[model samples]
Target: MPSLREDGAHLGSAQEPAARRGQLRLAALQEKVMLRFLIKKGTRMGLLILFAFMGFLHASIPDSGADDMEDISRFMENAGRIGRNIEIPENLHKAQGQKEAGKLLEYYQSEAFKRKYEAEIERLKGTVFKDTIDSYYGDSNGAEKDSVKGGTLPGNERIYLFISSSVPIGTLRNYARDLDRLGDPNVFMVLQGFVGGMKRVKPTMDFVRKIITEDADCDIQKNKCSAYKVKVKIDPLLFRKYGITRVPAAVYVPDVRIMDVTLSEGMEGNAKTGDHYVLHGDASLAYMLETLRRPSGRRSIDLLIEALKGGIYHEVNKR
Candidate 1:
C-alpha cells in the first residue's frame, strides 16, 4: 500500500536489531577465547617458576667428605693446645703399687674388674666431656705442652696413648706390654680418670704400675726400674679436643712444629708433612704394630693406624 521509497525505509529499520544482536554475540565469543588463552599462559609460567626454584635447592647441599675434613682439621688445631702449664695432681703422681706383681695381675683378671670396666665404658657412651681446660689452668700462662720447646724429648718424639680408667685393665696391660716390646722409650701411657677419685685412682695406678713392673724387678716407691712409661692426667678437655669419643685412643704428632692435621681423601702428600693423627677405639697390639709399618694411602682411622705403624715419632726424629 506504500510507495517504493517508503517500503525500502521500513525494511532497513527492521534489519537493524538483528544486525546488533549478531555483533554482540561475536564479541562475547572472542572474549571467552582470549580468557582461555590467558589462563593457559599463566599456568605455564607458574610451572616454569616452580621448576627453577627446585633446581636452586638441589645445588645448595654440602658435600659430606668436605664436612668431615673440616671437622678433622678443627679437632687437630684444638688438640695442639691442651695441658700447657698445668701441674700434675698429687694424687695422680702418687704410686700405689703392690710388692707381688702376680697378685696385681690376678686382681685385674678377676671378673669384678671386668664387669666394672665394661659398665663404665657403656656409661660413658654418648657422654660429651666438657671443655674445662680454660677453667683448670686459667691462672697459668697460655703455654701448651705440645707447643713447648723442651717439653718433649729432643731426637725422641713421643706417642701419647690415652686410656680411660673405664678401660679394661687387661687391655691396658697388653697395650703397654706391646709398646715395651717395641723398645721405644718415647711412648707415654696417659690415664684419663677422675682427678680426685682416690678410691678409683689408687687401684688404677696400682694396676698401671703392676703392668710396668710385671716382667721386671722394679721398686715402685722410686718410680724407676720399669720399662713402661705412664703419666696420670685428668683432662677431659684434651679428650674432647682430639675427638676421642671412646676409651683407649692414641694421638701422635709426626712433627712437633705441625699444629694440626687432617686425614682427608688423597692426603698422601700431606701425610708426609708431620701432621698430627688420632686412632680411636681399643686397638690391638698386633693391629697397631702393623699399622705403624705402613703410613701411606689411608684416611681417618685407617690413616691414624698407618701413621702409628709407620713409626711417626721415629720418622720425625730423623728430620
Candidate 2:
C-alpha cells in the first residue's frame, strides 16, 4: 500500500530538541514578563505618550488650523464614530491575540512539553548553578565557613599576615611572592572580613582570586584562576584575639600547645597559645619576619627568618 501521510507530516509535531528549545524560549519570555511587571507602573503612562508621538510621526500628519465652534460641533458629531472606530478594532485585535495565546498556552502546558522541560530545569540547576548556590548561602556564605581554618596549619608556631583590599597591589604582590618563597605551613594571609560588605560573597571571593594569582587577568571559566602557593583565609575571631587594626601587619605566634580539656561550669576553655611578636609596615614577608624576630631568638622564629634571609627584598625591615 502507498503511504497516506501528508508532505508536511514531519512538521506536525516538533522534535524533542525543538520542544526543549521552545521550553527555553518560554522560560526566557516568562522572566522578561516578570521584569516588565516590576517596572510596569512607571512605563505605562510614559509608553502611552511615546506611542502617541510615534503614531503622529509615522502618519506624517499635517498641522491643521484651529477649529471654530461649527467645526468643533462637526467633530463632536463625528467623535462618537471615532470612539466606535477605535473600540471595534481594539476588541477585534484582543480577540485574535487571545485566541493565538490560548493555543500557545495549551502547547506549553501539554504533557509532551512538560516532559521535555520539567527535568531540564533541575538538570541545569544542578550543573550550572551548583557552585553559585554553594558560594553564596548557609554554610558557604563566608561568614560561617572556616573562621580558623586556612588549609592545614601547624599546631604550634604560626604566622598571620594581616591584610585587606585597601592595601596597594604592589604591597600585595610582594606579600604573594615572599609567602610563596617562604612556603611555610604555619604561614597564612588573614583577612578580618569581606572586602566590600558581607551582604554579598562574590566581591570577597573575586578580591581573593585577584590577589592570589600572578596573572592580573584571570577567569575561572578559562581555568586561569591559579591557586595560591600559600593559604589565604578570613578569620574575624583571630583578628579580635590578636587586636589587629592596621595592615600590613605580621604576628609571629609560636609555642602554641593543642590539648583537650574537660567541660567547666558555664565557661569555655581559653585557646592555649604562645607569645605574639608583632611588626607593622608595608614591607616584604622576609622583612616583616626579620623585624618581628626576638632579641634572644627562638628556634621557630629563627627558622622562619632563615627561610627568607636569602630572598631579595626592596625595603629593609629595621629602622
**lDDT (Cα, tens digit) per residue for candidate 1, span 1-319:** 3223422222233446897757755766677788899999999999999999998888787667888999999888777666564567767533554445556546544678556644543432213111221221121222233223332233224456778657776787777655544434335565544434533644554554555544545564543343343333444444654566777877655543323222211123422334556666777855653454356322333533443455546646789
User: Candidate 1: which stretches are off by over 4 Å?
Assistant: 1-157, 195-204, 215-237, 258-274, 292-319
**Native RMSD of candidate 2 (Å):** 37.4
- Cα misplacement distance, residue 264 of candidate 1 (Å): 27
TM-score of each: 0.34, 0.46
Cα lDDT tens digits for candidate 2, 42-96: 6897898999999989789665656676798888889988877774343658878
Q: Report the Cα lDDT for residue 154, model 2.
A: 39
Error of 1 at 55 (Å): 82
